[model samples]
Target chain A: MSRLPSVRSLVAALAFGGLGFAIPAVAEEPALEIVGMGSFHVGGRLAEVSGQPPRDIVFTPGAPPARIDPNGLYAVEQMYAQWFKPRTERGRVPILLWHGGGLSGVTYETTPDGREGWVNWFLRRGWTVYNSDAVERGRSGWASPDVWPAPALHLPVGNPFERFRIGQGEGSYSHDPAKRRVLPGNQFPTEAYDQFPRQLSPRWTTTDQPTIAAYIALVDKVCPCVIVFHSQAGQFGFRVAQARPDKVMALVAVEPSSVGDPARVDVLKAVPTLMLYGDFIEQDPRWPTIRRTGIGFAERIRAAGGHADVVDLPAAGIRGNSHMIMMDRNSSEVAQVIQTWLQQKGLWR
Target chain B: MSRLPSVRSLVAALAFGGLGFAIPAVAEEPALEIVGMGSFHVGGRLAEVSGQPPRDIVFTPGAPPARIDPNGLYAVEQMYAQWFKPRTERGRVPILLWHGGGLSGVTYETTPDGREGWVNWFLRRGWTVYNSDAVERGRSGWASPDVWPAPALHLPVGNPFERFRIGQGEGSYSHDPAKRRVLPGNQFPTEAYDQFPRQLSPRWTTTDQPTIAAYIALVDKVCPCVIVFHSQAGQFGFRVAQARPDKVMALVAVEPSSVGDPARVDVLKAVPTLMLYGDFIEQDPRWPTIRRTGIGFAERIRAAGGHADVVDLPAAGIRGNSHMIMMDRNSSEVAQVIQTWLQQKGLWR
Candidate 1:
C-alpha cells in the first residue's frame, strides 16, 4: 500500500525555504446584495389619560435661548426597527436582534471600537437582519417621567469595565490609563473603554411592564422570526417565545439577565432556545443568581422535550469577551457560531 | 445654560411616528490599504544526522498504478509565515499569530463558521498582520516519523465538541445531530460542529522540543513582534518571550491549555503579557489546574514588576465563547479588545 507522504519528504519540501506552496484558487461568489432596506415602527397605543395639548416652554433670562414644544410626549411607546434583506436569503426565517438595557438598535450598527457590527456581518452571511430599538430605548419612544416613572440612572464611569469584566475588579478604572487595572487578558476595548459610559441612556426602574407590552406587540407584527435578545431584553424575548411558540422560530439569548417563569417553561418546549453568556459573569455578584435561574429554566425546557442549548463563552475558549457580545471585537465570530447553530437546527437554508 | 436634552424631549422626539431621525453622517475615511504582502521561512538547523538518499518506489502488479518519491524529508522544520503590511502602519509592531495543537495558521484565517477572521480585521485596523504555521504544522515541514515519535491517534469524532465544550459532555456528540448534548449556552458553531473533526491534523506528543526551537528561531527572525498564541501554542509562545524578552514586545495567550514553568516567570517581567480564558473552563476536568498555574505565573510576573493581565472571558459578560477564541464568532471582538489594550500600553501607535 502507498502510505502517506513520509515525514522526510515533508521536511525536504521545507528545505526549499521561502518557497510558498501555491494556494489553490477558490471560486469567487457574488457579494451579498442588499435587495431591500427599510425602517418601521411597531407596538404603540395612544393614551388619552390627559386632555393636555401641545405647549411651548420658553427659556427664562440668563438661560440660553431655547424654546421646547413638548406635546404628547411619552403618550406612546413605539419601538422602531430597521431591516436589511439579502438578495439571496440563506436563512429560512428573519433574525430580529434586540438590544440590552440602556441601549437600542445602535448596539448592532457600529462597535464601540469603531468597527462594523454584527448586523452587516449577518447580512454578508446571506441573512435578513432586523435590528430593533426596543420600547423606551433608542429610536423607540419612551414614556414621559410624569406618566411612566422615569428615574434617570447613570452608570458610574468605571462600572462598565469592572462590571463587564473588561477591566479588573473595583480598582480597574482610572483617570490615568496607565494605572487602570484591567483583566490581564481582557478582550474589552480598553482604549475606548471610557467611551462606553457616554453611550448609556437614562433608564427608568419602573418601565418594565410597558417595555414588555411594546416588545410583545413588535413580536406580533413580525411573527415567525428568530429573536436575539441581549441583556434586559432576555426575559422579554423568552416571554415572547413562550407566549407564541408558533411566532418565534427560535430564541438566541445573549447574556440574558432573566427569563420567563421557570415553572411554566413547558410552553417553551416548541421553541428551540439558545442562551449565550459572555465572560466575567462569575465575578458579578448579581449574574450568578441570574445564571442559576436561567440554567434552571433551560434545564426545565429541555426536560419538557425542547431544544434548549446553553453557551458559556468563557468555557468555549472565547476569553476576555465582554457583556456586549454583539459589539465585541470578535462579534462576527460569535455570530458565525450562532449562525452555525441555526443551520444545525435547519433554521438556516 | 442650555442643558442636555431632557428625557421628555428624548421621548418626544422619539414619538414622531414614522419620522426617522436622520442618522448623523459620519465622515468616511479611506479603506485600509495593504502596502505590501510577503512570505518567508525561518529557523531550521541543517541536520547531518543521516546520509540517506532519495529513491522511488514502484507499485506492484495488483496494486493501483503509483510511483512514490521518498527522500530526505524531516531534515528541516523551518516555520513558514505570511504577512500583510497596512499602508498606514498605525501599529508600531507587527502581530504574529500562532495556532493551537493540531492546527496551523488557518486558525487565524477564516473561522470554522466561514467568516472574515481576525487576520484581515487586524490589518484593517492598520496593523501589520503575520499569520504563521508553526514548525511541523501546515506549511511548516513535518519531521520524519523516524526522527519524531508520531502517534497515529485519531481523535474520537465526538471528543472535540465535548472536550472543547462545543457539545454538552462525553455523550454530547451523536451521529444524529439532534441527539447531540451540547452545553446549554454554548456559542460553538453547532451547525457546522461536525466540520471541526475533519479539520483536525494528527499531532505528535513528542514534538515539543523541536517546536520550541523552531518558534524561538522565528522570534529571532522577526524581532520586537507581538505574539498572539492560542491553546497548545501557549506554552511555546511564553517560552519564546522568556528566552528573548528583547525580541517580544507583548504576548497574548488565548485560553492557553498550558504555559512555561511557572517558577521562571520572573524573566517575563519585561514582556507585558495577557492570558485570556473563555467559557466553560471550570467544567473542564484538567483546565482548573492549568488555570491555577497560569494565574500563579502571572502573579509572579506582576510582582516582579512586569505587566501580566489575566482575563477570564465569562467574567467580562462575554459568555458561550469557546476554546477556539481565534476562530470563535466574536474573534474580532476579542482582537479589537487586544488592540485597544495595546494602544493603551503605547505598543500600538
Candidate 2:
C-alpha cells in the first residue's frame, strides 16, 4: 500500500512510541489525497398537492409579483449521501457513517469545537467514507406537513446536556457557562458546548419507512460495506444490515439508543457487530435501560452463532464519555477502539 | 505556484485545445490535495422558550421515557460553512459560495443530475472555497415556531419549472414526463428535472435580519473574500458587501432576484461586482421586471463609481440559460465566464 506521510500520522506515531498503530492526534490535519468525491440522493417519492389558496407575493421585495401555486407534484422523503474515495484502499468495504436523530452528516464531518471528525479519521485509514444526512434532515430536504403529519421535534438546549451525560444530571445545564455543570471527568469539551446545538437538526417522528428505504438503496449502490452509526441511527444500522446482509459486512453502533426488530435479529448473525456504550449511564435518567436493551440484542446475535461485542467504556478502563461519544474530547481514542475491532474481524485490509 | 496535473485539467486542456485558459470538463474528477478542510458555524442568538406544554414520548420505541422540554434558552439562526483549502493557493482571496432561497450549500455541490457543481469548479482552479448553508437552512438549524411564527414556505415541485425558465412558459409543466414542455433550447438537464425538487428546502419569509447578520458574521470570519451568490441571496450579497466593503473584495450575483439597499449603494464603490442574468427573462412573467431592477442596481453601483458589469447571457451569445445557470447543462461554460471575469479583475492569480 502506498502511504503518504501526514503530520497527523507522524504525531500519532510519536505519541504511540512505535506501537505500530496510527492513533490520530487532536490537531488540524493536512488535506487528504483521494481518488474522488461526490454526492447523491436516494429513496424519494413524488406526491401531488392541491386545493390550496394561491398567494401572489414578491419573491424579491421590488420584483414583479409571482404567484405561489400551492398545488403540484412534489418530491419528498429522500436521504442524501456524500462520499469520498481515498487514493489507496485499505479496507475491504466502504464505511457508511450515519448520524443519530435530530442530527445530520455534520456529526461525522467536524466536531463542534472544530476538530477532525470520524469521517476524516476513517478516510485516512484507507476506507472510502459515505457520510449521510437521513431523510428530512440537512441536505435531505423535508416534506410538507401533509406527509409528515406531526410537527418535527426540536431538542431543547438543555435536553441533550443532561440526557447525553454532558452535565451532572437533570437541571444541570445553565445559560450561564459558569453555572452549567459538567459531569466529573466528562470527556466533552464543555467550553464548546454552546456550539454543539448548532449541529442539532429538527427531526420528524414519522419517516422511518422512507429513511430505511433510502438506507437500503444506499447499501445497494455501494456495498458490501460497514456501517458506523450513533445514537438514534443505531436501529437503522441493524435494520439495514438485516435487510441487506449480503451487502453489510460489519456494524458499529455508538451509544445506539435503539436496536433492530427482535423478531428479525437473527438475520444479522453473519454480520460482525460492535456496540459501544459511554460513561455515566448508571447516573443518567434513561441510558441504563437503553444500554441494557442493546446488550440483550447483542447477546441474541451471539446466540445465533454470530459475533457481537458490547463494550462499556468504563468497564473497559476507558472512561469520561457521553452519549455524544463522537463529539467528546477523547473521540479519537474511542475511534481507535473500533478500528482495532474492524482489524480483528479481518475487515481492515 | 505548484500545479498538479489532474485528469480534469488535462481533459479541459484537450477540450479547449490549449487556448491557454483551462475550462472544466464534464466528468467525475479527482480529489484535491489541500492544506486542510473543516467546518464551523457562525451567527446564532440565544432565545428562551416558556409556557409550552411538556410531552412525554419514546425517542426510540423501546427506550425509556425522555421528557420533551420545549422550554429553554435555545440557540437559534446560525449559518454553517464548510471550507476546502487547496494545496496551491491561486487566488488572492478565498471565494465564498452562498446559496439562494429554498436551497442549501448543496446548490454548489453535485448537481441534481450528478454533475460536478461550481464548488469543485472553483476548487479545481486552486481557489480556497467556502460553501455555506445560510441561516435556517440545511446544517443551519431552524428556531422553533415561537421564534419564527410563520410556517416555512415550501416550493411546489412545478413552480421552478417555468419560473427557472426550464419550461416554455406558465402552465408548461406536467407530472407526466412526455407531456412536460421545455423551452425551445433550454440548457437545463430537463430529464433530471424530477431530481431538482429534492434540493429545495423549507424557507421562512421573514428571516432577513438573522440571515443577514449570520452572513455578515461569516464575512468577518473569512475575508477579504469573493462572494458568489444566486437568486434570493442577491440582496444579502449586496447588503453584506455594503456592510463590509473592506472585507468583501468582489461580488458575483447569478441571476439575483433582488438588489441591495438603494440608499447605501455607494458603499460598494470599492468593491467589484458582476450581475449575471440568464435567457428567457424577457418573456417571463416576473424576470423582466426583476432583471430591470437588477440592471438598475448595477447602474447605481456604476453611478457611485464602483465597477459593475451586468451581463445578460443571451446577449453575450450564451443562449438557452436558466435561472439555475450553475446546474445547467453548460454549467462549466458559465463557470468559465465567471472565472474569466475574475481573471480580468485581477482577483484570480
Top model number, TM-score: 2
**Model 2 agreement with the true structure over B29-70: per-residue lDDT tens digits:** 444654467788898898888999988877777888777878
Find the candidate with the highest lDDT and give its number.
Answer: 2
Candidate 1 lDDT over B7-104, as tens digits, reads: 23432443442112222233652244554444555665433223544332211111122222222222345566666666678778889888887656
Candidate 2: list runs displaced more than 4 Å: A1-31, B1-31
Clash number by candidate, in order: 67, 0
By summed lDDT, the worst window of 10 consecutive residues in model 1 chain A runs over A58-67
Residue runs of model 1 more than 4 Å from their true location after superposition? A1-349, B1-32, B48-55, B58-74
Model 1 Cα lDDT, one tens digit per residue, A69-172: 23221225556666667767887888988887665565776565666577766776678888876665544544444456433343335545555667766556
Q: Per-residue CA lDDT of candidate 2, range A5-60, in tens?
A: 43244224434433234444647643476556778877788877788888876665
CAPRI verdict (incorrect, acceptable, medium, high) for model 2: medium
Give TM-scores for every candidate, taking all chains together and pairing residue i with residue i: 0.45, 0.92
Model 1 accuracy (lDDT, Cα)? 0.64
